[model samples]
Target: MAASLFLARRSLRLPFPRIVRTSKWCGVPALGVHTTAGRMNTNQQDFEKSQNDLKILKKDPGNDIKLKLYALFKQATQGSCNTPKPGMLDFVNKAKWDAWNSLGSLSKDEARKSYVELVNNLVSSEAPLKDSASLSTREQYDTLQVVSEDNITKIFLNRPEKKNAITLQMYEEIGLALDEAAKDDSVITVLTGYGDYFCSGNDLNNFTSIPPEGKEKMARDSAVILQAFVRKFIDFPKPLIAVINGPAVGISVTILGLFDLVYATDRATFHTPFSQLGQSPEGCSSYTFPRIMGLSKAVEVLLFNKLLTAHEACKLGLVTEVFTDGTFQKEVWERLRAFGELPKNSLAFSKQLIRETEKEKLHAVNVQECERLRERWLSEECMNAIIRFFQKKAKL
Candidate 1:
């Protein structure tokens, strides 16, 4: 198993400085605008204010409010949503596209003005924007810490008491952070865990709280959110690095396969107990692990539930390096800073070339895994296992 894994790892090693030239697709042609300098400044001010209001409203808004905000923002920025409507079953996307497209022939300035007015009205009647933090200012999140400086963004899993267990909200916040990282070309993202562990995986309390009758609904809903979160990582164009501080389990361990680099503390360990939990593989590990660690090692980790030490993980090529616990975080950050100092486009395009070939296959596997996971979530075996697992935790 080790020999085959080693040979497979050799095949997956990235080629440096090969410079694969590729054509870039620039989406949405720029619209011509004829406005006086003073008018441009006024329009820009209104746009900025509208953006701030939208950010404030996003703190806690109903689905209706969110859709409205999305529409107004898109209209103001893009000038009337020229993209084709999403498919029928894509209800959320279609609703957003329709809402934006409804304001047909509205000019950018007019849309911006309308957005400001709508936000002001919403704030006055329903909620006050003053009560919420502006989106421009980074608010400290409950479950994660996102700090960007020196051209490196570090996203830390902050719920140490629960062993950094990921809640649904944490997943959303991580997705948002990734979205931000995608927009900013200057920064590289580094994901790490706080306290003694990287991530204990999903907070089972959230999953077990679903009533038996609501299992199917919860399965579908959670799958949608989880799939979106996983897709964000898979499609992330910028360099993403993972720093494993300690032991990691479940999705936390599997997710390392998607990162551009993974550095771990010598004390860190990785385990995927999906089968024990009556669940299947996630984070496209079903596809990526075999490609990284070979089929036999992938089975041992995903099927037989093997727990690998950091050194073993590095040997299997899942981790780039394993550092002593004392200096792990510092060393990882230093490397990230060094990486950030390199030519940004060169790194990004290199990563793109390396990953673009596997993008379609990874997406397909993610879809298939989500389908299987949904079934597993709704199954009697999974339900029973979850109950027992919770009972065991309670005893502890």
Candidate 2:
């Protein structure tokens, strides 16, 4: 059993698409208007404009005066809604829980655009905003639109075409985003992915694109990317939560092993079929799976290539909780917010200590597992198995 486990772990490979590059942009396109150097100037202008508008509104609280002034401001901004988004509004409400009675008449569109621009500004500047602590934004792919919500401190993985299959660029962007989050005191927790489907795992198309000869290098490099993402999630003092909405396979399922809390929908599925596919789990599942789910359960999941439903995963201690697909988001929000509502600093410190102590050893184990996997991926035996599988699929 131990030998089989070792062989399976070594067979894992991280494939990258040679023909296509992973995008750094999360989901938004480049405006080309604000350069990184000039982002500060743009933000200062927006900040000043917002401040001036605030002063006028404070001077006159009367409905007639406030309405007239706000309307004019709206027109000047081309009638764009300045109202915060559902996620942003939630944060604002928390900050000013007592004062926030009802939302004022403001345009949602205006708020969204403004928020996007602000994020772009920070990305260009690579600097945190004055009122805001840290901000990082990047497009994950050319076609996909993955934006980090303003107040939620969320990182959305949004490549629907390939089911959010992670690429080299996506891994790099995620690593940088976490680094930025680490620097900011305000960012207490990091939430990942959109509704369902955290990540579909490795892009199989990559097998055909890259030089098959360099397959070993590609897998090793990809392992580095997964290592960075998992290391950050595991070591970061802040809470790391993964909202698994749909299918999570391969590296996706393994990466979840690092998250402190995981909430999956009833329809969600988690699996690591590397053995069936003739590979292994690169994100340190060799070590993490056995520790979290026990050796017997880990072997059942990794060696047999079994797909576990949300309920099944919960039974194996893989998932924290499961809810109906429709109500998953609402329930997750309520649960996370309750945690966020606690003394922010104290919560952060406690989370950090727990992660550091437990994850420190796993990090080393992950490095060892990944290095060995690269060697196996380049082995002739595994190569022949991969070739046979693909040839069969092509015949079908």
Stretches > 4 Å off in candidate 1: 1-137, 211-213, 391-396
- Report the lDDT tens digits of candidate 1 across residue range 122-199: 343222113334212246577876666557766777775566777777888888988887887455888886555677
| Cα lDDT tens digits for candidate 2, 140-198 | 44422333333335566655435566655666667666776666644345544532245
Question: What TM-score would every model get versus the actual structure?
Answer: 0.64, 0.61
TM-score top scorer = 1
Instruction: Go through the candidates in order and give each one's C-alpha lDDT.
Output: 0.69, 0.55
